[model samples]
Target: MTSAQVAKEHEGGEGNRPEEGYERGLGSRQVQMIAIGGAIGVGLFLGAGANIAKAGPSLILMYALAGVIIFFIMRALGELLLYRPVTGSFAEYSREFLGPFFGYFTGWTYWLMWVVTGMAELTAAAIYINYWFPGIPQWVTALVFLIVLFVANLISVKLFGEIEFWFSMVKVTAILGMIVIGLGVLTLGFSQAGDTAAVSNLWAFDGFFPKGVGSSLMTLQGVMFAYLAVELVGVTAGESDDPEKTLPKAINTLPWRIALFYVGALTVILCVVKWTEFADEGSPFVKAFEVIGIPAAAGIVNFVVLTAALSSCNSGMYSTGRMLRTLAENGEAPRVFRKLSSTKTPALGTGVSVIFMGIGVVLNYTVPEKAFGYVTSVATAAGIWTWLMILVSHVRYRRAVVAGRLPSSAFPAPGGAKLSWVAIVFLLFVTGLIAYDADARVCLYVMGGWYVALVIGWSVLKRRDPQVTARRREPEFEKL
Candidate 1:
C-alpha cells in the first residue's frame, strides 16, 4: 500500500485501532520492562555522581521530591492515556485540549528532546566502555552504537521491544544486586567499606545539606533529567497489546521504581559510602562496588551502565519515529515520515533522527570533555517543555470532563486537576532552576531558537496544508 493509504487505514478506517498502521508488538512483559528501563538510565548511573558531589546526601531528597511530582505527572498522563491512548500521547493531548500550534510544537520538541538525548546516551555509553577500553576514541564507539541501534530499530517494533526488554532487564537486575550488596555490607560489616559504612554517613561529613539547601535544590535539574524517560511508557500506549491493562499497571509501578532505583538506591549507596568520595565523572554504582572492594567491580557496573545508556538511546530512536509519524499524519512534519516499511517500521523518521544524533559523534570528537554536559542540558530543557505540555493538557482535559464536554476517564487521578496544576508549577520551577545554572542556561537559549524555528515551520505548514491549522473535533460524552 502507498504511504497515504497506510495512514488512512490506521487512522480513518471503521472498526480499526487509531494506531492501526503500527504493529501491536509490545506485549505486557516488554511494556513493564520498558517502564523499568525508562525509570533508570544514564542520568542515575552516571549523572548522579556529579549531582551527589554538589548536593551531598541531600541529593537523595532531591530525587524523592522530584519523584513525587513525577508521580503526579504520570498519573495525569495515565488518565489521558485511558481516554485516548496513542503513540504520541503528549502531542495528541496538546492538539485536542490546547490547540494545533501547541501540538505541533510539542511533537517536534519531543522528537528533538530524544534526538539530543540519544546523543547524550551515545556519549555516555562510550564513556562507560572507556572503563575497559581507554584507548578507543569516544566518537568511534558512539558511532558504532548509534548505527547498531538504528539498524535494530529499522527491522521491526517487535525486535525493538525485545531488545528493550533485555536491556531493561539488565538495568533492573543490576540495581537490585547493588542495593542488596550495599544492604549486606551495612548489616554484615564484612566488606572493606563496612568498617565505615553506616546510616550515619548520610548525616556525617558536614551534615546532609552540606552544600546548603540552595545547592541541593540546584541539583533538581539533573535529578529531573534522571527521571526524564520515565514517561516513555505513555508513548508505548500505541503499540501495547492491552493499553488499559498495561499502561496503568506500568505507570503505577513508577513510584517504587523511583523509590528503589533512585531514592532507595541512593540512600543505600550514600549510607555505604560517604557522598563526598564520589567522583563527578564516574558512575556512583561503579564507585560503590570498587570502594567495597568487589573484584572486577568497575568492569561489572560499567557493562550494566553501558546497557543503561544504550537502552535510553534505543528508546529515543523508537519514540522519535512514532512522534514523527504522528506529526506527519497530522500534516505537521514531512509526510514521508508517515511511511512504514514492510517490517512496519517508520524507517524514515528513525533514519533522520539517528542522523541528527550523529551530531553527538562530532561533539564527542571535538569536545569530548563537555559533550555529555552540553547534550544533557539541552535534553533536560526540552524534556521540561514536553512535560509541561502534558500537565497542561491533563489540566485542560480535566476541565472539559468537569464541564460535561467530555466523559471522565476510567482511571481518574486521585487529586484530579489540582495535582496536575501542582505538577505544572513544579515543572516550571525546575525550568527556572535550569535557567539559573550557568552551564545549563544555554539550553534555554537553544530552546528559544528552537521555538522560533518551530513557529516558522508551523506558519509554513499552515500555508501548505490546511490541516496543520485545523482544530481537533470535539468529542461527545459517554462513548467513542
Candidate 2:
C-alpha cells in the first residue's frame, strides 16, 4: 500500500476506530491544560533557582530567546500535525518525509527520552515529598508516586487528562498568584519594611548580567530543557476530540503562555527578590514569597513544585505509552505493545514503561545526589534529537506540498521552511552548548551509545522480520 493508503488505514479504517484504537477522550480543555502543564514543570519551579543563581537576572533573556525558538519549533510541529494528525506524530512524519529508519529511531528515541525524563521527575517528586514527610525515604516516595500514576494511566486516557488538567490548574494558579502578589509588592510597596520590592531590583544589586553575558549564554541548555515537552501538544492530536481547533490554538498561544508564565513570572520574581538572594537549592518562587513575608511559603511552594513533578511524570507516562504503541504499529517495537485495553489505552506499553520507571525509584536510593543531573542531561540530548527530527520532517513536508505530492496544510508554519531551518540551527547551537559543558558532555556520549544500540537493534529486528523491513521500504506517499 502507498503512504496515503497507510495513513487512511490507520486513521479511518474500521480496525483502527476509536473502540479498537486510542479513544478521542481528551477534550479541548484537557488538551489546553495539558499543553500549559507540559510547558511549566519542575524546570521552572525548581531548576530556575540554580539558573538564576548562575546567570543572575539575565536568565530571563535566555528564557525569552529560547521561548522564541520553541515557538518556531512548535509552529513547525503544528504544520505537520495539521497535515496529518496521527498518534505517532513526529515519528510518523519522519517515516513519511525522512525514511523508515528515521521513523524507527525517532519513535524509540522519544520513548527512551520520556522514560529517562519520567525518572527525573519521579526523583524530583521524591525530594518535594521530603518537605512534607521528613522521615519518609526518598525511594519510598518515588515508589508510591510511580504506582499511583501508573494505575491512573492504566485506567483510561480521560482519567489521565483529568489528572493533568487539575495538576496544570494548580501550577497556573500558583504562577498567576505569584505574579499578582509580586506586582503589588513592586508597585504598592506591599512587602515588609526591609524587603524592597521594585522593578529596579532587576539591575540594582549588580546589573542584569552580573555573571557576564557568556555565563547567561551557558544556561541556554537548561532553558531549552524547560521547553522539552511543549511539543507534547502534537502527540495529543491523535486522541484529541478536536485536533484541528485545539492544536492550532495551543500552538498559537505559545508566545502568550511564555510571556505570562516564564517571562512575566520571572520578571516579577527578580523584582520581588534580588537575584543575589536566590539559592541554587531552593525554589525561586518560595524564596520570593519568603522575601515578601509569606508565612507558609516553603510548604506552599513545596506543594506546587510537587504537583509540577507529578504533572511531568503523568505526562511522561501518557506519551511513552502512545509512542510505544506507535512504534509497535510501525514494526519498530514488539507486536505485543500494539495491544490496547478495553478503554483503548496502550496498557501493555504503559506497563512496560512503568516497569522501567521503577528503576528510577531505585536510582533515587542508589545515587540520590546525582540522579536528577544524570537523567536530565540525557533527557535534554534526547529532546534535542526529537526537535531536530520535527524540523527536518517539516522541511520535507513542505517540499512535498510544493511538488504537488501532498495537499497544503490548513495551518502551515509561518516563514514556510525557513523558520524550520532557523529553529534547527538554534537547536544545534544549544547542542553545541551542551557539548561544551564538562558536566553535560556525558549526555552526548550516552546518546552516541544509544544511536549505536538503535542501529544494532534495528539490524537484528530486520533480519528476524524481513516482511517488516520490506513494508518499511514501500512508498511513504502516493504519487499524484
Candidate 3:
C-alpha cells in the first residue's frame, strides 16, 4: 500500500497516540502549504529592515550565504526525516540517535524557541494594532490577537492549516509584488518626486561591502534566525498523508522556494534602492511599495506586516503544540499533552501554548521596545541549537545506514558525511557571531540557563524514578 494509504489506515480511529495523531489526512498540498505558511513570516517582511541597515549593500550576501547554509541543513534534516518520520522531527531524531540528554535539550529548546517567537509576534501584532487605534492599549491588542490565534488553533488542525495557507498567500503575494515592482522601478527608473531612481544605487553606496565583510557576517545573527522555521516541513511528516512521497516533494522544493522568496526578493530590493535609504525605515517592504507609487504606502505595508506578525504567531503556536505533543508521546512531557481532539490536533497542548504566548501581553505593556530584540535573540539561540542537533543526528544516521542498520532507499543528503560536518561547523560559526553581537549575547546566557534547568530536572527525575528513565532510554537503544 502507498504511504498515504498506510497513514490513513493508521489514523482510522480517533486515537491520540503519536503514531495515529500524526496520521491525519494532511495531503501533499496541505503539507507544502503548511511548510511555506509556517515559514516566510515577519522575519522577512517586518524584520528585514533592521538587517538591511546592518549589512548595508552587503545584506544581499548575508542572506544568500545564510540561505545556502540553511539549504544544507534542510537536506540533512530531510534525509533524517525520510528514515524516521516522527512527530517531533529533529527532536525525535536527536533522541533516537544521540541520547536522552540530547533529546531533552532539543525538545525543550525548540519549544522555548516557538514560545518566545510566538510572544514576539503577539507583541508586534499589538504594536501594529496601535498604529490604527493608538487609543487602544497595547495589552488589549495583544490579548485580542492572542485570543484569535488561540481559537483558530483550538478548532482543528486543518483549521490551523487553512489559516496558515491564506496567511502564507498574503505574504507570498506581498513578496512577489515587491519583487516585480522593484524590477519595474529598476528598469524604468521610477522614484519619489524628490529622488532619482537608479539601479546603480546598489553599489554606489560606499561599495557593496561598505560595512566590511564583518558586517555581513554580523547580519547572520538575524538572517539565520529568520530562516529558523523553514524546517517546519519535516515536523509535519507525522501528520502528513504520505511521509515517504509528500515529504520528499516538500523537501526538494525548499531550494527553489528559498531562492525565489528570500534571495530573489532581497536581491531585487537592494538593486531598486540604495542601501543608504533603507536605514531607520520600519520596513523595506513599505519603502519598496512607496517608491513604486503605491498610495498610502505606510498603511498598506502596515496591514501586510500585521498579517505577517499574526501569521508568525499562528505558526509559533502550531509548532509548539506539535513539539509538546511529540514530547508527551515520547514520555518526555506530561501525558496530557499527548491527548488529541477529534480533529487529530493536540488540543490540550494548543491551549497550553496559547496561554504561554499570552505572557507577551504583559511584556508588551512593560518594556515594549526591547520585546522584539529579546525574543529574536533568544529565538536565534534556540534555532542554532536545533540546527546543530539536526546536523548531529544526520551524522549518527549515516553511520547507522552504513552499518546496514537503517534503510538506504530514503532521501539522501548530498555529500553524505562531509556536508553534514560543513553545515555543523557553519552553524557553529553563526553561533560565534551571535556571541560577538552585543544584542544577541544575552541569548547565550538565557539558553545556558535553560540547559542548566533541564539538566537539574533530569537529574531529579532520574533519582526519583528509574522506570521513567528506562522508558525514555528504550527507544534510543532500539533505534540505535
Q: Tell me each candidate's TM-score.
A: 0.94, 0.95, 0.93
Model 3 stretches with alpha carbons more than 4 Å out: 1-17, 190-195, 471-480
Model 1: what TM-score? Answer: 0.94
Model 3 per-residue lDDT tens digits across residues 1-480: 332333345443322245554535667777887777555777787678888887886777777778788888888988877665667787777877888668867988888998988888888888888888999988888888888888888787677778888888888888888887777777776656225556576688788888888877888888887787888887777777668888778777877788888888888877776677786547888877776678988887788888888887887787888888877776677888878877677878878888888876686568858757887889888988998999998998788778866555367998997888998898888889888888789999998899899989788767876565555333221332
Q: What value does the lDDT take at residue 12 in candidate 1?
A: 44
- Candidate 1 per-residue C-alpha lDDT over 341-444 given as tens digits, one digit per residue, 9 for 90 to 100: 99988899999999988986686667757756878888888888888998999998888889877777778988999998988989989889888888889999
Whole-model Cα lDDT per candidate? 0.86, 0.86, 0.77
Candidate RMSDs in order: 3.9, 2.7, 3.0
CA lDDT, candidate 2, residue 365: 67
lDDT of 2 by residue, 1-480 (tens): 433345556555522321236788999899999999878988898889999999999999999999999999999999888766778787887877788889899988999999999888898889789878889988888989999999999898899999999999999999999999988887778667235777888898779899999999999999988888998998888888888889999889889999999999999999888898877777899898888888999999999988988998899899899998888887889889889988888988998999898886686667758657878989999999999999999998899778977777778899999999999999999899999999988999999999999999989988998765555433224532
Least lDDT summed over 10 consecutive residues: which range in candidate 2?
A: 11-20
Decide which is better by lDDT, 1 or 3.
1
Question: What is the TM-score ranking, best to worst?
Answer: 2, 1, 3
lDDT of 2: 0.86
